[model samples]
Target: MLVPSKIQTMFAAFYVCLVFWCLDSAAGAELAPPRNVTMVTLNTQYTLCWDWDHTGNVTFTTQHIARYKLNSKKKSPIWSTVCKDILDRSCDLTLLNLYYLGIHVLRVRASVNGRHSDWVQKEFSPDKDAALGPPTNVILTPAGSDLEVTIFDPLSSNNSSMKELIPTLAYHIMYWERSVDSQASQTHQTLTSSINIVILPNLKPWTWYCVIVQSRYDYYNKGSNFTSPHCMQTEGATPWWEIFLYFLGSLVTCFLVMFPSVYSSFWCYKTLKATLFPSHQLPMHFKEFFGTSPGSDVPCLLTPESESELLCDNVTVRLEPAILEVHDLPPENLPAPLLGLKPGSSAQHSRHDSSSSGDSGVYSTGGRSNSQQPNTSQPIAGVIDCWNGLDAEQVKMQEMALVLNSRPKIPADEGIVDMCV
Candidate 1:
């Protein structure tokens, strides 16, 4: 049992030394130098950034000294620690109040657990290293064949106003007619800083034009990309040929719209006049009876027959057997379309047909070709008599029923109706 206990103690000592070696190796690997030290400048601001390999929390330290100070052999190179123990990999050094156009060297190192890595260094100049950005959301308006363009400045990655931070920022605008090739188009440019608007004068009216704008900082020699082309049509006075075309189109449209209405109203008026007041000549004998004697100067007021008289137009219907014969023929035997039908074959077959053909209730669409409809002859006798004694008998019957007051009336076969009054 004593030998077994001694072996166990020796094994515990070996395990402790192995753990110490591993911890030391891990510490050495973690304290490696930061990679890719870079200096970035935007306008008057300066930033120092670096890349690191390890994960988890880390702190960085940044130092900068003027390039001229490094070249002086007599002066001691003093690198002030502008950023100390920062969690972020990038550091903003604008607060240090360094000269913007002056060249400077920047260095960064990683720190964890009181251990430091070797410094990684880079050189930067605010005048040459800064990047420029383009204007955004360009707008164009037409001022009577002239175009007015408005430019708005761009924003930084954090959406802050980058133009306000840049004092020397200016804009360059170019415009040309759309009909010409962009490479060969007539264009002009001028630097504008105070105002965001520019005008292009004397463009052709009703013509299209394109515009593009870019921002630049002349002092820093930084220029951004140009914006996308914005094309718009210009407005101006009207041309004579165009006005004539518009007038012609309006005249044709109005005629097409009003023609149907005019024709329909005229047709309605003619039809109504013919139906309400049929035109017929007075009989010659009747005209002579009502006329004054050729030599007399007396008015008809003293005439005996004109004093009290009931005047009515006498009409005589002269329906022929040939018309009846023509009406009774079958549709197939009538005729083909647009050709006249002369009926003679069915004349002797039926006399009963002539008797009933005058009634309106017996009307039919037959007696015409299958390929076409039969024409309805105008100046129709039936339509002329429609408002005459057509409904007189029925109206008289209604009046008689009203007088009876629901009492039973004598049948027509009795030849008499007793009066209530």
Candidate 2:
């Protein structure tokens, strides 16, 4: 009985283990795998994305492996973990540094509450599946009448350039004259696969042009989307023959202007001497009349004897203080002590000769050369001798009288002359 019981107990434990395994399988099957696993690229960046019916804070994990490793028969290929326990369905895969020109495989699965769904994965070729992006930078330049365009290549997350991956890459440029209303024509130009910079020839001078560029891979028959229109102005254009003609015409004009002026200046210089004086020699008699000859000296203004006899006379001028009406004054009114002699005496008369003179007491500064006597003196309006005989009181009275009885006169402010006159 004990041996039978032991066998039945072992069987019952096996059945219980089978039932638990079935239950865990049913729970895993209920959790759905992620859908639409795909890789997206922009510039040099790569991202992994998927779709799922999310519920109750479920998280996701992503992994990737090289497609070539999966194809090898030697050993099991290991999958690289891109993202784990991530709340978002998308995972950034640029950190893996995958090769751009090779095939790759990526997988993603969702997990919730210690339960995990099966992984959903897909194969990807970054070379064939990746799209060619438009040039990262486009530059426009005006080359005289032509417009030049430069296209730069797009970089990839695989540490390479699109041009390196696709060697047949080229450029398609379209440009036209920009209208004021913002309309342009559909003029297209395709460049060689090796060319990145090209010159658009025969553009209008000083006009605006709009340009759009797209990258092309002729071998794959793929092209990137057209870039935004870039507008620039072209420089002025002129033909070589026209410029040469202008230069020649300018030289001719300068010659035509300068030649006449030079000729006129030279002609005037040549005739200036003749216009000022006659060309013929001066007559001999005129030269003699002008006294330019050595023997023709001017006659001396004074003979030798006259030069020795010329005398300078010493003329003395006397200034006498005489009032104008003093001659009619009585001699008894004069104070005799001040002067040397008494009045009315011969000595006084001799001292004051003009007091008794017939010339009305007017004194003289210098006598005439012909005057030989004192009484017969020239009554020059040079000195006033009449005030000499008057006392202080009488002189004061006479000054008042003179100032009252006569009109005031202004003298000239020129050279010195007698003020008494």
Candidate 3:
């Protein structure tokens, strides 16, 4: 009952040819060019991208399209257009591992069930660099807190010398994930030779992204070849308030660190000033006047006993009665007569014991000394009353006479006499 293997193979081939013929006849009825066709060179391969609007007789389904088979590269159909969900009418990687160094015809065809779309074709070259090798690795990853694309020089080796990694290379990187060549749109972001390199900071927290890098070394400078694309995702940023608080705390710490030095400087100034000028040192003139003026009086310097005897000296004592020989009717501008003495009005002779008193004891006792003048004068007939209300010249004469009587005798003009105040 088992069929022969050769017969089965023949039958299968016939059935496949019949299916192809039916598809060809149907495709001929609604053939049209594919819309929005474009080509991108990635390393040694070219990915021809486009969108079919299903405007033709064919509907947009994965099965309706065939893979790209450019004849010059000697590559088979790598992958049919099998993916859908086009974000902006774009497709990806219809050809890989098939790179023609120079221009080659690129084409795509579509089929619906038994029907086929017209062949849409263009010419392009996948050789981005003349130097041929496996693609250089483009590492796109989060560096610390930021997203960065790092290019590893194929010429660089762990054990090799650095001189091989020439600095003369120029790089170009282009990428579009959500939409092919999306930078062409208002939302599209482009990268060129001038701005092809990128480092991402202040990114959204805990988000992911896709990126690519391509490089070319200078042929004249002997630079390396182009690199493979890199894709990455990154976590976002910390709160702004956290950074502000950190700065504020640092300022406070700096102030605290300097506080002790500032305080010590002030302390040193106070100590130095105090040592140079003590608090209790007084002015020179103050000490001189108060300490010495009271001691200058000669009488204050005398002994108490000597002072008492001088006050009671008998020379002054003996004259106590005679000194008042002018015991007044009443003193005009002088004091009353000495105590225990008679007035001139008494006609009787009044006498007292010699021991009773003297002019010095009566007037100069109690330390007064003989400098004091008795106020009484002798009862001159008209002389006493005549001197009353006298002018300044007559008064001077009376004073002269009194001083002369107190002594034994003195010529009127002998001693210096001062009548002016």
TM-score of each: 0.40, 0.48, 0.23
Model 1, range 1-421, lDDT digits (tens) per residue?
A: 9999999999999999999999998867747888877767654566778889987677999988999999999978999988899999899987876665688888889887788888888888765786666886799999888888888877654466656667667888777777665567465544355468878787789999888888888875678888998999999987899899999999999999999999999999999988887687657555556554454444433456765564668989985322111122244532232023143211111114666454322112223332232233333233224324446664333233222222222233433322221
How well is each residue in 21-131 modelled by candidate 3, as lDDT tens digits?
A: 999986567755467777654334334567766653444322122224433367554534444433333344433334333445545666555565676665654433223
Q: Candidate 1 at residue 189, lDDT? A: 41
Between the candidate structures 1 and 2, which one is better when assessed by TM-score?
Answer: 2
Compared with the true structure, model 3 gives a TM-score of: 0.23
Which ten-residue region of model 2 has the weakest summed lDDT?
342-351
Task: Give the per-residue lDDT of model 2 (tens digit) for 1-421.
Answer: 9999999999999999999999998865768888887778754477888888767879999888998899889998999888999999799977876676788898888998988889888887766666678887789998987888887887666556677777777888888777776454555544443577888887888998888888877765777898998889998857799899999999999999999999999999879977887689667666566665557664334668988888779989997534332222244644443244333211112224655454343332232234233331434122124545566665554433322222222223322244231
lDDT of each: 0.66, 0.69, 0.47
* Predicted structure 2: lDDT: 0.69
Instruction: Let me know the TM-score candidate 1 reaches against the reference structure.
Output: 0.40
**Alpha carbon deviation, residue 326, candidate 1 (Å):** 99
**Which stretches in model 2 have alpha-carbon errors above 4 Å?**
1-28, 158-161, 183-193, 238-421
Best-performing candidate as measured by lDDT: 2
Question: In what order do the candidates fall by TM-score, top score first?
Answer: 2, 1, 3
